[model samples]
Structures are given as structure tokens and as C-alpha cells.
Target: MRILIVSWEYPPVVVGGLGRHVHHLATELAAQGHDIVMLTRRPTGTDAVSHPTTDTRVDGVRIIATAEDPPEFEFGRDMMAWTLAMGHSFVRTGLRVLAGERNTPEQQPWVPDVVHAHDWLVAHPAIALAEFFDVPLVSTIHATEAGRHSGWVSGPTNRQVHSVEWWLATESDSLITCSASMRDEVTRLFGPDLPDVSVIHNGIDIRTWPFAPRPVRSGPPELLFAGRLEYEKGVQDLLAALPRIRRTHPGTTLTVAGTGTQQEWLVEQTRRHRVTKAVRFLGAVDHQGLVGLMHRCAAIVLPSRYEPFGIVALEAAATGAPLVVSTAGGLGEAVTDTTTGLTFDPGDVAGIATAVRAALGDSAAAATRAARARDRLTEEFSWSEVAERTAGVYLAAKRRVRHPVGRPSIPERPLPERDPGQSD
Candidate 1:
């Protein structure tokens, strides 16, 4: 199958889970003999003059960086303006490719068997391209702004995100979401007949992140949190729970590993709660640093209020770090109580404190459970397996587009068993 993947972010440049998801999915598809082409905005330092004003191949997959003439780098301005301008350029250039305006004998236009768009950020380009090319488009809704803010906030950026999401979901041949909760949200917002939506849970690279023997903490029992320090992530809730946690587990300490809008607020909470000494805020640790932390930590907590699919939980599970997740949104789907990890109700300070203490005290039992979780992750949610499942979705979209009616009745294959921690 020839697949053209449209996304706003890619590796060597990380915005969020969307970029990382696209990168891994594309690579896995290409490895499985699918002809893959990725379309994204040109990254920083892309030589407009030297860089092909056209298609280029990276790691056996064609990559089309948008806009032949990119804007000159300007320092000390509103970054959002620059991002919007670049996004526009990317969409315009992608539209041209889909329209077959820049075709060549050596590199023909992207006549994909499937047009797959990752998220709302690239929906404009994906929708335009699908229309121009007259191909079946499969869109993945990684997150919904409405779901993120729970309709409480509707500012300009939030509104725009929701608008694009609506357009993309309405236009797609088949829509894909990471969790069932997300599917419910989409149906509630868009009504039925919006699109033929499917749930394809996000997966991790199990081989690369095999379960290692976790290191025993010599000094303090380190409880690790690795994500954006925002309200949705429940960082504030974690911070608030720390005061009660330290009252019992004095040797317990927290090592935060990401930064976001709520950094200052989190710091304030730490100080006000007088648990600053127990918390070490290591802002934005890189991939290797995170893996190291996972191996060393006594427990890995993902207290998200609205996680579409907890990819981070899978990553930590793959490393044999017993999980502690909140019972909210997709997080409930990502942890099995006392099996893979334990769960606590969101904002239940006593429950969270109790869970943390329990996890810290029984290092040996947690290690045993972590090993089982790792085995489950590798068997059930490997990237290669998810890629094959996703390919089936692409084929389904193509078949529907090619023949709307009178097609031979085909029985749907029974989907793989929904792991207790999975979101189908």
C-alpha cells in the first residue's frame, strides 16, 4: 500500500505525543513493505536553497518538507505567529503535491492508497489534499480541545483547534481515535454519521524498551512523574497530595520530568505545601534521561485527567516500573489495578498518598508485577502489531471509497482481546 502520512511534527523535533506516534507508525509501516511518504512543515535550519524544493527520501521513505522558500529565522518575536505562518506554508505546499502540480518522472506525485492525517493541526492540509487527490482519507484524532478543556475554555486557539477537528472528522472517510472515551466524545459532539470511526490504541516500541532489572533506590524512594506540568496532566493534584504523602513516607521524593504552562504554579504549590524539599523538578528530561529515570524510580505515576491513550504508561510499563494512574478519562483504560499498576481516583489526596506508599514499600512485589506488565505490553501492544492493525483500517477506507454499495458482504475479524490497560 502507498500511504501518505500528514503530520505537524516529526522526530528530531518533538511537540507532543502526536509527532512521536506518527514517526514510529510510519517507520513501522515502511518496514512492513508499505510505500510511505510523510508530509510535514520544514524544520528549523532546512536549507531552502540546497534542500530539494521538491520530494526527498529519508530512511527509504519519501519526505516532502513544505514551502520551497521558507521564511528567514527571526529571533525575539511571538513564536505562535511564526508557527501559524509555517503551518500555512505547509498546507499550501501539501495541497500542490496532492493536486499533482509538482509531478516528475523520477518522483511522481503522492498518489497514495491511503491519505492518513495524524491530528487536527494538519487537518487543513490533509482534507485539502484528500479532496484534491480524490483518495480515501483516514484521520486520527489524538486529542480534542473540547475534551481537553471540557468546554470550559473557548479562546481563539481552542476554537480554531475545535473547528479543524470538526472539519477533519466530518471530511474523513474513516476516523480513528486512541480510546473509546474519545470516540464517545466525538459522537456526542458531531452526532452520528459524522464518520466511520474506529478505535486503534496507541502502542510502544517494546523491543527497544525491554524490561530491565530496575535499580534499587539506595537513599530515597523516588516517585517519578514524566509529562507536561499542566492541569489536564493532574500535576497540581499530585503536588497537593505530596504534603500528606510525606507525612507518612518521609523518605519518599518526587522527580518531575517535564515542563509546561503550570510550571510556576506547581513550584508555588510545592513551596506553599512545604514539600519543596521532597520534590525535585527536573524540567524536560530527554528520552534517554527519561528511560534512566524509569529504571531507577520506585514507581511511575500518570495522574492525567483526560489522557486519550496513555503512551507514557506503556513506556514505563515496558521498563518494569509499576504504574500508578488516576481513574479519569482514558487513564482508566491504561492501568489494571494490582496487575500492571494501581489506580486512584483523581484528586483523592488520601488515596493517592496511600497508593504511593504501598508501591514504595513493596519494591519486590512491584518488580514482579512490573515484569508481568512488560510481558503483556510486548505481546499485546507492540508497534509492529499496531501498524498491521492500522493498515487494515487503511484498506477498509480504500475499499469503502472504491465501492460504496453492492460490495460482497465481509465479516469483520474479531478484534484482539482488549487488554485491561487498553482503550478499545
Candidate 2:
């Protein structure tokens, strides 16, 4: 099967779990002998003369990375404008790629059997390409706007983003989500008339994670929290719990890995909670550093107020790291309360402290749970297993009969005259 995968981020441009999900899915599909063409933006800017629309292969997948045409847009600062401008760039380069304008035999035009879009960022391009080519539009809503804001889409910018997400949900023929909770969220937000949403949980490669024996040895009880430091992540709750956690377990410390808009606020929170001396903010630790921390840490706790799916928990579990996660959205589905790992309520400061203390204090129980989590990954979250289920979705999408429709036109002017640096 010939498949075209569209996403905003990929390797070297990973903003979060979405990039890793797309990369693994594309590579795994290609490994299964399917012709996979991934359309993503170049990490480094490119122009016609300098480095235009690179076509390269990695792990049997053909990656066609296009550049920002106007080259004046920045994702963080000009989010809404950047999205509209990005839609134009995607459509322009996508048409050329489909038309095989290069004329070279190797770079000749190729028709994809189905178009799979990752999220709202690439929705315009995905819809345009699918409509123009008369192919099925399969979309995966990794997370929703309302979900991030805890079902509050009150502000103008938030509403604008929500409308785009609804447009993508309505335009696509088939839909996919990372978890059952996300599927339910989409249905609740979109309507009673949307198509069936397939629930395909995120995958992890155990070989890369490489499980280790995590017996709680004698050392500082270091609890690791790895993810974006956003409001929805509930890192503040973790900080609030730190002081209480220290009452029971003396010499306990926390190592925070990652950075976001809430970094300063979270730092202030640490000072307010008087855990400034105990908590170490190691902002934006790389994957290598993160894994090392996970192996050595007594336990990893994820106290999320709104988590569609906890991919970081899976990564930690694969490394035999004991998990103490909040029962928020799909996080509850990711870890069983007593079987695989300990669970707590979202934003519950006392719950967070209790769960962390449990994992830290009990060496035998923590090791047992961590081992169970590592074992669970092989059965349910392997990359090959995830790819096969994803392939099934593509096959079903290909079988759908699409009606001829006009492509969505990109506006000449950007979304707003002024730049609003707001995005999820």
C-alpha cells in the first residue's frame, strides 16, 4: 500500500510525543514493505536555491520535507498566522510533489492510496491534498484544544483553534485517536454525527528503552518528572506535594526534566512551597540524560491534570522505572492502580505525596510493579504491534469511496494582522 503521512513535526524537530509517534509509525510501516511517504517541515529553514524540499529515505521511509516559503513565520510568536502561512506552503509544495514536477524517474510523481494526517497543524494540507487527489482522508486527533484547557474554550484564540480542530474532525472520512479517553473526548466535542473513531494507543520500542533492574537501592530517593512544564501537566501539584513527601522520606529529592511556558511559574511555586532546596530543575534534559535519570531514580511520578495519553510513562515503564501517575484521562488506562504501577487523582497534592512515598519506601513492591510494567509493554505497546493496527486503519480508509470535492483555498492574508504567540 502507498501511504502519505502528514505531520507538523518529525525527528530533530520533536516538540512532544506526536513527533516520536509519527516517526516510529512511518518507519514501522515502511519496514512492513509498504510505500510510506512522510510529508513534514524541514527542521532547518530552506529556500529554492539553498536547500529546497529535501527528499530523503530513513528506515525505508521516503521523507519529503518542505520549507517555509515566505520564511518570515515563527511557530511560537506567530502561531495563528504561522499556521495559515504553513497551510499555503504545504499546499504549494504538495501539489508539486503530487504532479511529479521534478520529472526525474526517481523523483517522479507518486499517488498515495490513502492520506493520514496526524493533527490540526497539517489539517489544511491533508484535506487539500486528499480532496484534490480524490482519496480518503484519515485523521488522528492526538489531543484536542478543549482537552488541554480542561474543557474551557473561552478565549478568542482558544475558540479559533477549537474551530480548526472541529473542521479537521468534520472533513476527514475516518478518525483515529491515541486512547479511549481521547476518542470519547473527540466525540463529546465534535458531535453525535461524527464517524467511528478508532482507538490506537501510542507505541514504544523496548529495545531503545532497554529495561533495567530497578531495585530501590540505598541512595537519595530521587523522583523524576519528565514532560512539558505546562499548566495542564499539573507540575505545580507535584511541587506542592514535594514538601509533604519530605516529611516521611528524608533526603528525598525531585529532578525535573523539560521546559515550557510554566518554567518560571513552577520555579516560583517551588520557592513558595519551600522545596527549593530539595527539588532540582534540570530543564530540557535530552533523551539520553532522561533515560539515565530514570534508571537511577527511585521512582517516576506523572501528576497530570489533563493527559490524553502518557507516552512518557510508557518510556519510563520500559526502562523498569516504577510509575506513580495521576488518574487523569488516558493515564488511568496506561497504568493499572495496583497491578503495574501506583495511581493517584489528578491535582491532588496529598495523593501525589502518598503515591510517591509508597513507591520510594517499598523496594520490593516498587520493583515488582516496575517489572510488571516492563512486561506489559511487550504485549500491548510495541512499535510493530502498533504499526500493524495502524495499517488496518489505512486499509479500511482505502476501501472508502470519496466524493469529488474542491480543495480548501489558503487565504492571501494571514489569520490576524497582529502576531499572537499562542498555541498548545
Candidate 3:
């Protein structure tokens, strides 16, 4: 199938997990004998529009990037202005791709078999292109504002984000989510009209993250936490757990990775606990260094308040590091208790310490679990499997669009029971 993917971020310029997700998906699709073209917003480069891009060919698939250049608009510090700019850029790019596809003859058609878009950031373009080309559209909702806030308050910004999500779910032919839990979130937030949401769990490229012999910790057992440090991420809770954790295992050290707004609070928490020396604040390590550290660590911990699907856990699991994650959103789906890794309540500092200590205490057992983790990643979370499932969703979407003449339109019915981590 000739698939056109519209995303906001790509490799070497990732704002969040979405970028890496799209990157691996496209690569895997190419490997499966599908032609893939990516339409994404250019960071800040003034160069050729249809230039050679990342991992363009795999197996029989051909991939390319169609960069969108939006004229700079002064928002004057208004949040709405930023939203408008994003919308305009997406809409304009979608229109451009559609027009180009239409101009070409059917014998050598540029029109895509399916238009698959990654989030609200690229939804405008995806919707616009589908309308212009009259092609089926599939949208993947990664996370929602409600999920982010955890129901504290639904402010205007939150509403705007929700509004865009609603528009995409209503406009697209099919909806895909990372977890069954997310499928429920979509139905609850966007109403039951979403034509049977599908769950396509997130996956990692296990091959790229090659395992090497890790260095024995000359000093203390190293523990690593990577991601945006925030209240929702439960980094502060991890710090609170650290003091208790050290009393039991004094040789253990915690390494906090990634940067976010909660840096000050985390720093203060370390000071308040007086375990600043034990906690190494390694803010924002890149892909290579982070994976390398994972291989050598006692365990990789993620104490998130809520996670749609934790990709970091998969990486750590793939590298054979003992995994410890919070029972947040879809994270529970990723890490198996006492098999691949351990889990604790997002808010329970004591529980987190217990899980962490348990993972580190049984060195032989952890090694066994680590081996199982790497094996599980290969059996379940490979990119090839992810791409095939995504392709099936696109095919189903196309089938729905083609057979819309006689039969009753498939009413977007919400699932009877909430299924977390349910992807097509």
C-alpha cells in the first residue's frame, strides 16, 4: 500500500514520544513492502522541499518527507495565536499534498491508498488531505488533555486540545490508540460516536538497541529514571522513595534523566531528603547514551502518575534492564509483575521503594527477568508487528469507506467495557 503519514515530529527533532513512534513505524512499513511518504513540519531549515530524508528505503518500501513551510506569524504571546498558526500550517500542507496528488494521472497516481495521521498536531493536514483526495483517513490519538490533567481541572487550553481531538475523531474514517485504556478515554472524552476505536499498542525497534556487556558498577548500584520530570511523572515521589530505598540498600544510587518544568521541585526534594549525593541528576541524555546506561543500570524506573503507553519501559526492557514502572495508564500493560519487571502505585513512595529494592535485591532473579524481558520484546513489541497491525487498520478503514453505499453506516459505538492497551 502507498501510505502517506502526516506527523509533527521526526527523527533528530523529537518533541515527545510521537516522533520516535512515527519514525519506527514508517521504517517498519517500508520493510514490509509498503511505500511510505511522510508529511511533517520542518524545524527551521530553508532547503529543498522534496529532498532525500531518513531511512528512505527498507526491503521494498520507499519513504520520503514532504516538509511544510509555514510563514512566521506573530502571536503576541497569545495562546490562541499559536494554535491558529499550527492549524493553518497543517491545513495548507494538506491542501498542497492533495493538489499535487490530484494533478498527477491515475496511471502514475500520487494519491495515497491511505492517509494516516499521528495526533492533533497533524490532524488538520490529515483531514484536509483526505477531503481533497477523497481518500480514507486514519487517526491515532496518543494522549488526551484530560488524561494529562488527571481530572483536576479542564481549563481553556485543555478544551482547545480536546476540541481538536474531537474534530479529528469525527472527521477521520477510523481512530487508533496506543492502549485499550486510551480507547476508553477517547470514548469518554469524545463521546460514543467514534466508529469503534482500535487499539495498536506502541512498539520499539529491538534490533537497533543492541545489548552489550554492561560495566560492573565500581561504586554504587545505578538506578536510572528518564522522561519529562513532572508531578504527573511522579519524579518527586521517586525522590521521596529514594531515602527509604537507600536505608535498605545503601550501595544504590538513582540517576534522574530528562528535563521539564519540575526540575526545581525535584532538586529541592533531593535536598529535603538529604540524599542529594545518592541521586545523580543526569538531565536529558540522548538515545545512545540513555540506552547504554540502561544496559548497565540496576534498574530503570518510571513512576508516572499516568501513562498512555510508556515507550521508555520498552527500551529498558529491550536492553535487558530490570524494569520498575508505576501503575499509571498503559504502563501496567507493558511491564509484567515479577516476570519482565515490577510495578507500584504511582503515589505510593513506600511501594515504589519496595518494588525498586525487590528488583535490585535478587541479582540472579533480576538477570533471569531481564533475559525474559529481552525475549518478550522480540516476541511481542517488534516494529514489524507494529507496522503490520497499523497496516491492517488502514485496510479496514479503506474497506469502510468503499462499502458505505448500501449497508447501515457503522455507528461509532464505544466499547461496552474499557480495555486498556487495545490497538487494532
Candidate 4:
């Protein structure tokens, strides 16, 4: 199979788990004897004049990293304009590649059997390229704007993003989600007439995250929270539970290893909770550093209030870290209560404290659960299994009739469609 995977981010430029997901998936697919081409962007403010497109190959996948257009556009601040610029660049690069403009003896022009897009950010380019090439378009909805807002499209930007998400869902031949919970969410949000929705749980290859279990643990008892400091990530809830956790187990501290829009707010929160001294905020630690923290910490906590599928949970579990996670969204499916690790309800500060205390107080049980979680990784969450399932989705997508690419024929909502000719 020849697969063209489009995403806004890739490795060395990861904002969240989506980039990691795509990176592993593309590499694994290429290893399975399939030709894979990854289309992504260079980081912000990169020189598009000197080098418009960069071609590189790593671990069997051919990656084409395109630079952002000139006349500077910041991502979050310039949302819609930036997206349009990126789509135009993608179209240009895809056309050049297909036309053999940069063909050499070593690298020949290629056409993909299927075009798989990661999220709504690259929807326009993916839809256009798939239509132009007459190949099946498969969309994976990593997360939705409405889902992030707890089912409310609050502002204009949020509503626009939601519309684009709906457009991607409507335009693709088949839909894929990281978890069954996410699949259900897609069906509920994108609704009555969607192409077959498939659930392909995210996978992790533990071989990469090598860890030697700590012999003599250093410093105070540490709990690790390694994800974006966002409201949905539930990091604030973890801070709220810190006082109670320290009550039962004195001098217990937390190590946060990520940054986000809520970093300043979360910092303020630690002060208000009066556990400021106990909490150490290490914003955005590298992967190796995070794995080391996982190995050293008493427990790895992922208190996600709206996780599509917590891949970090898999990473932490792979390091033999005792898992303490909230049973929200796919976290419920990922971490089995008591078997793999301890589980709690989302936003339940008390449950978090209790779970953490248990993991800390009972060393033997925590170690046992940690071992169980590590063992479970090989059987359930291997990248090989995920790649195979995704290949199956590609085959199924190829069999279906492709949807026409344009403004959707269906009604658009959350913000009603405006009259084409009437002036506001």
C-alpha cells in the first residue's frame, strides 16, 4: 500500500500526543513493507524563501516538511489565515511531488493508494489532494473543538474550527478515531450520515522508552504529571489533591513536565492551594527526562477530564510507573481499575488523593500493579497491532465511493449558514 499521511505536526515539533501518534504510525507502516509519505510543516518563522520544502527519510518513511509562507502568520493568534496559508502550501507541494518536479534517480515520483489526514487543521489540503488524485480520503478525528469546549462552541474561532471539523468528517470516505469513546463522540457530533466509523486505539512501542527501575529513590516521594497544563488535562485537579495526599504521606511532592495556555493559571493555583512548596513545575521536559521521572516517581498520574485516548498513560505504564488515572473518556478503557493500576473518576480530587495515597502507602501492591501494567503494554498497545488495524481501515476506505470535495451539501450548525447574497 502507498499511503500519504498529512498532519500539522510531527516529531521534533510535538505539541501533544497527536504528533507522537502520527510519527509512530508512519514509521510502523513503512516498516511493514508499505510506502509511506508524510506531509508536515516546519516550525513557525522558518525561511520559506530559501527552502520551501525539505525531503528527508527516516526509518523507511519519506517525509516532506514544508516551510510556512512568508508575511509571517502565528498559529493560534492567526488561526484561520494561517490555516489557509498552510493549505495553499500543501497543495503546491503535493502537486510538485506528483508531477515529478524534484525527481532524481534515487527518488522517483509516487502516487498514494490512499490519503490519510490526521486532523481538521490539514482538512482543506487533504480533501483537495484526495479529490485531485481520485484516491480515497480517510480522516482521523483526534479531537473536536466542541469536545474541547465541553459541547459548547463558545466563540467565533471555536465555531469556525467546529465547522471545519464537520466539513472534514463529511468529506472523507471513512472516519477513524483513537478510541471507542472518541468514535461515539464523532458519531454524536458529526451525526446521522457518516461513512463507517472505526475505533483504532492508540499504540505505544515500549522498546523506545527504555528504563532501569530506580534502586534507591532520590529526594521526596514524587508524583509525575506529564501532559499539557490545560483545563481538560485535569492538572489543576491534581494540584487540589496534593494537600490531602501529603496529609497521609508527608512530604509527598508533584513534578509537572509540560506547558500550555494554563501554565500561568496553574502556577497561581498551586499558591492558592497552599501546596506551592511541595509542587515543582518543570515546564516541558524532553522524552528521556520524562521517562526518567516516570521510573523515579512513586506514581504516574494522568487526571484527564476529556482524554480522547491518553497515550501518555501507555508511556508511563511502559516505564513500570504505577498508574493512577481518572476513568474519563478512553482513560477508562486504557487503565483497568485495580488490575493494571488504580483508577478514579474525573474531577474527583478526593479519588485522586486516595489513589495516590494507596500507591504510595502500599509499596508491594503498587509495584505489582505497575508490573501488570507494563506486561499489558506488549499484548494490547503495541504499534504493530495499531498499524495493522489502520491498514485494514485503508483497505475498507478504498472500497467505498469517495465523497465530492466542496462546501458540504448538508446543513451547518452551531452557527447557522448565512445567506449567500444577503449582506449582514
The digit string of per-residue lDDT tens for model 2 on 268-363 reads 888989989988889888778988999988989999999999999999999989999999988899999889999999989999988888888787
Q: Find the 10 residues in a row with the least total lDDT in model 4.
A: 415-424
lDDT of each: 0.76, 0.84, 0.75, 0.85
Candidate 1 residue 159 C-alpha distance from true site, Å = 1.9
Q: Against the true structure, whose lDDT is highest?
A: 4
Name every residue pair that clashes in candidate 2. none
TM-score of each: 0.86, 0.92, 0.85, 0.92
Candidate 1: pairs in clash: none
Q: Residue 211 error for model 2, in Å?
A: 1.5
Across residues 1-424, which tens digit of lDDT does each residue of candidate 3 receive? 8788888777655788899899889878887888787766555343235432233443343434444334444333444555455556656554555444454366344678889888886667687777777889999999876677664223455566667777777777888999888888888877655676898888888877776544565666888998987667888888889888888888678888898777877788889888888888888898788888888898888999878999888888778788889978789888788888788987799999999999777877777777787888888887888999999988888524433322212223332232121111
Off by over 4 Å in 4: 100-109, 214-220, 399-424
Model 1 Cα lDDT, one tens digit per residue, 306-375: 7888888889999888888887766777677888788998767778888887887788888877877888
Error at 324, model 1, angstroms: 0.8
lDDT of 3 at 276: 85
Q: Score candidate 1 by TM-score against the native.
A: 0.86
